[model samples]
Target: SSSFFGDYPDVVAFILIVIVGIFVAMGSKASTNFNSMFTIVNMAVIVIVVGYGITFADFSLWTGTDAEGRSNFFPYGVNGMLAGAASCFFAYIGFDGLATAGEEAKS
Candidate 1:
C-alpha cells in the first residue's frame, strides 16, 4: 500500500501554509474577546509615555545659537516646519488605507 503523505516538499509547504492560515483566522476571532483590554493597555502606554516625556522635556533644544550663530528657534522659519510636514505627508497618506479598512471591518 502507498501512502499519500510521502516526501513531497510542495505538498508539505502547502499543508503548513493552510494550517497556519486557519490558526490565524481562529486567533483573530478569539482576539475580539480581548479587544477592550487591548484598548485600555494601549491607552495606558500612551499616557505613561506622555507623562514621562514632559518630566524630561528640554526647552533648551528649541533655543541657543547654531554653528552659524543663528539665534532663531526656527532657522528657516515656518517654511522649514512646512517642508518637514510636507515630507511626512506620504506617511499620513498611507493611513488612508487603514481608514478605508474600517468600512470593510463593519461588515
Candidate 2:
C-alpha cells in the first residue's frame, strides 16, 4: 500500500479503520460475503500466476546439474535441509495457534 499509495501511513491506517468499521457495522452476513468474494479472487490470482510462471520454468534446474557438468543437487546437503525445515517450522508455528484462538471467541 505504501508503494502504491505513497508514504502516508496515517491516511492508510484511517482508511483501513473505516473499512473495518464498515464491515463490522454491516454485520456477519455482508462480512462473510465479502470474505468469500475476496477468497475467490485470491485463488484466481494464484492460479493465473502459477499458470503464467509455468511457461518460464526450467524443469532441468531440479536436477542441480549446471551447464559446466557439475552435479550439486543438495548444495548444503542433509544438514541444510534439516535447518530449512526447522526454520520453516518456527516461522509457521504461530499460525496454528491463531487458527485455534478463534475457537474460544463468542460466535
Clashes found in each candidate (C-alpha, N, C closer than 3 A): 0, 0
CA-lDDT, candidates in order: 0.75, 0.78
- lDDT at residue 99 of model 2 (Cα atoms): 59
Displacement of residue 103 (Cα, Å) in model 2 is 3.3
Point out the worst 10-residue segment of candidate 2 by lDDT: 98-107
Q: How close is candidate 1 to the true structure, as a TM-score?
A: 0.46
Model 1 C-alpha lDDT per residue in residues 1-107, reported as the tens digit of each score = 88887666687789977865665467655545455566799999999999999999877868898898866578877888899999999769977996687446632
Prediction RMSDs, each to the true structure: 9.9, 5.5
Candidate 2 has a TM-score of 0.59
Task: Report residue 75 deviation for candidate 1 (angstroms).
Answer: 2.7
Runs with alpha carbons beyond 4 Å of true place in candidate 1: 1-40, 61-64, 67-69
Would you estimate the TM-scores of all the predictions?
A: 0.46, 0.59
Query: Candidate 2 on 56-83: residue-level lDDT in tens?
Result: 9877766866666656566666888999
Clashing pairs in 1: none
lDDT of model 2, residue 26: 82
Clashes of 1: 0
